[model samples]
Target: MSGNFKMLAKTLYGFEPILAKELRNLGAGNVEEGVRNVTFDGDTGFLYKANLCLRTALKIMKPISRFRVFSEKELYRQVYDIDWSDLFDHDKTFAIDTTMNSEVFNNSLFVSQRAKDAIVDKFRATTRQRPNVNTHDPDIRINIHLYKNSCTVSLDSSGTSLHQRGYRISTNIAPINEVLAAGLLLTSGWNGTTDFLDPMCGSGTFLIEAAMIACNVPANINRSSYSFMHWNDFDDELYEKIIAASLNKTREFHHKIIGYDKAPSATRKAQENVDNANLSEYITIERKDFFRTEKPVDTKLHMVFNPPYGERLQIDVEDFYAKIGNTLKQNYPGTNAWLITSNLEALKYVGLRPSRKIKAFNGKLESRLVKYEMYEGSKKAKYKTDTQ
Candidate 1:
């Protein structure tokens, strides 16, 4: 616990490499990428900094114990062997979340229940007291991962998901997740060099994320709570120092970050969220139809948006996507347009060859983040010769 130890940062699908890059950039040691997670070595202060600054990570966990187990009895014994009371107080309410891919364990809930019992029994035997289990909200979160016959027990240093940046108080029907929005913005190579836009922005998620990335702001600077704060060995002064250091690293962003939503309610909510994030000085929300409007700036524009996926919002998918292509090709030139949509069929209706397409997921729906580079000159003019 005192020296450098390994930790894992969980992320969304296809974001492992970027998350790893973030960890390495933050001075993490021995960084390695997994399927949907990245493993790195860091001390306690670095652990706090990782939670504070990582943009693509959903959760940061520190593994405490690793062993091999075959039977349920062995699992309980392995869990009981650890001194749980030393890690957290007996009064601190805790919950166990188990994820497994093994033939021995048929149910994850049963595993969690057994592990919880083991922890309780161990505490009762040693301290003559046990902590209560709070499923909805817990002071301490324990994660159990079993792969094949090997098991690793981890402490979830992040209380809730990092996506809850504690900035948004209002949201539309289909608001994008903050972490995903940031990851998408990074994927599009947006660095605050030029103007940024999120046309059809819902609740201004992409707008806020873009602004944060542009200024090098820590991802969870607004968040106040974490599961690590409840640990017995927690150092409040160290955490505060980490926060101050992270805040000191933020740089100035001169470019503008803009969002457009035709719905009045969406624009209002977006403005409220921007104010909540304290980034109103850098972002602007407007209620304007994207198709009817031209580019707001003449400089190179970077665009990333999560358009309507036709899940709940009813509209002509073909026509809406076609208009997007037409508007980008005609109205919005000199822009690197990127959009994510689960509707694979509707992508063809856009009628433009994508410069790049990356696989991604919006919740459970399979999606693609496609990029269309609208050159400076007119796309039609480039092709029109003597045919006119």
Candidate 2:
């Protein structure tokens, strides 16, 4: 067994705890949570497993060096001291991303530029040839974090964000990030046990992510690319073994996973993406208006989705939200519905108060993930007072 090394997995707001939990469940050691990242320890194989299985991680970073920097010269020298040539080949491509939270550095782009120059100079001096810099898509992506005088450099193991699961080629008007979708599902206490639905559906992100979680499938099982694959120390056999072991652990899901969208275009796109994930058998996408339809199943239903936050949908936000509450209260019962939206004002018109409200961010918009419960068998659903 290779010895353990420290790593960090970045995530969205309010997701640190879930990411930490995911890391612990994946056998990571000393798991700790940060502002938007979780720190943990694992070996190389564990790293591969993390990249493959973590549903909430945006990217897994392997910190290689940490030092105190005082000046640009020292920064260049320190960055250049690393053995870049040993990490990847001279023919490979690379890109540097810098995050500065200190007064010592003003511009992140400048810092990234300095680091990139150091890497290029290091390669030229050592191997008489330098790797090309490809920002859009690179073989290796490097990250630099600066906090006051402390600087740490790490490698981005997952080239594209884990949200880019590679299965979502067909997108709708508003598609939730895959990692964020999975995290929201977990937060709503969704597993593979009960029926699930995405009323608005969009591109069926929640449906696909929920199905994967239900079956214990690796989040990135459908993705074929990773920056680690280009690393000099990458072991193809070890990765294959990890994939096989992960696939073996997948459990069977028995509950119904359905999606409903009023727009036929959305239903078509959702079905296309579901097929891409090879989950068409488990998820059913229907071109039906949720407000006019009743729950397809008689059992308990768990629903989570991202409603149009008044950005793309040209309708009265307040009236639309009110209709949502009325539909659930009148038509759907024995259901737990969770929705995320940036329009806080529209929530008040819903009439029924949310049982739970959690702060979350849908991209740049500060939003709330609210839950409403519709009781079964004629017991009037109680409304919580809208406390804006």
Candidate 3:
């Protein structure tokens, strides 16, 4: 907790590499990527920075103890032995969340219950009082990860998921997750170098995320609270310094970020969210159907959007997708268009073979992020039709 300590950042599926890269960029040591999480070494100040700056991370956890427990009694004993009093006060409400993948311990709820009892007993024995349990929202959140026989206990530094960036209060139908939007933009190699557009911008998640990435701004600058502030060792001065330093690193972006949606309600919601993020100067939201309009900018354009899948909205899948292809091929030349959709069958009707296809997930639905490159002139021969 003083000089340096190991921490874990949890992310969505396929975002481990992005999270690891973010950790390394933030000056973390011994960076490692796991399935849906990244592990790194950082000090207490670095921990604060990670919570504030990481865009793709859902939660940041500091592992306090790791042990082998084969039985329920052993689990309780190992958890009780730790000095829970040293971590937080007896009056502070606490909650134990458990996740396990072990043949020995089949129930995660039972494990959480036992750990909670152990902590309560420890407090009662030491201070003659016990901390109350808060299941919904607690001052202190302790994580219990049981893999086979190994258990790793960690303190949750981030109370809510980082995707709740505190900027999006208004959302349209089926808005994309903020973390997922940021990850897909980073994966698409968006560096804020050229004009950007989101043709089907729902709730302006991509628009806001793209502007933040463009300006090198901290992702959660608008968020006011984190679980670290509730810890006994929380340093107010150090956290303020970290926040100021991050704001100082924000560079100016010289590109237009535009968003368009057919629905007036969607456009209004996106504008409100963008205004809440304080990014109205950097982003512009409009009500225009993508298929009915041409490219807004003459220079190079980079687009990433979450289009409506046939499964979510009732529409003619083939006609909608075909119109999408026709609009791009005829009007929006000199552009790179990337869209994510769970409707895999609609790709065949787009009429343009995708230049790049990456497997992704949109919530519980499996999706594909496909890309199409439109050249400046004579774009017909540059792309191949599905029939060809």
For all candidates, the clash counts are 0, 0, 0
Residue 183 local lDDT, model 2: 93
Looking at model 2, residue 364 earns an lDDT score of: 89
Q: What is the TM-score of each candidate against the true structure?
A: 0.97, 0.96, 0.97
Comparing 1 with 2 on TM-score, the higher-scoring candidate is 1
Scored by lDDT, the top model is 1
Candidate 2 per-residue lDDT, tens place, 1-388, comes to 2589999999999999999999999899999999999999999999999999999999999999999998899899999999998899999999999988875879999999999999999999999999999999999999999999999999999988999998897887668989989999999999889999999898899999999999999999999999999999999999999999999999999999999999888999999999999999899999898889888899999999888878877788887888899998988888999999889888898888799999999898899999998888544333332232
Q: Could you tell me how far off, in angstroms, the CA of residue 353 lies in candidate 1 after the best superposition?
A: 1.1
Q: Write down the worst ten-residue block by lDDT for model 1.
A: 378-387
Tens digit of lDDT per residue, candidate 1, span 1-388? 6989999999999999999999999999999999999999999999999999999999999999999999999999999999898899999999999999987999999999999999999999999999999999999999999999999999999989999999999999988999899999999998889999999988999999999999999998889899999999999999999999999999999888999999999999999999999999999999999999999998999999998979989989999999999999888888999999999999999999999999999889999999999987866775684267
Evaluate residue 76 in candidate 2 and report its C-alpha lDDT on the 0 to 100 scale.
Answer: 94
Candidate 3 C-alpha lDDT tens digits along 1-388: 5899999999989989889999988999999999889999999999999999999999999999999998999999999999988889998888889998986799899999999999999999998999999989899999999999999999999988899999998987788999999999999999999999999997999999999999999999999998899898999999999999999999999989999998999999999999999999999999999998999999999999887797767889999899999999999999999999999999988898888999998889999999999888865655554238
Q: Please rank every candidate by TM-score, starting with the best.
A: 1, 3, 2
Candidate 2 worst ten-residue window by lDDT: 379-388
- The alpha-carbon deviation from the true structure for residue 332 of candidate 3, after best TM-score superposition, in angstroms, is 0.5
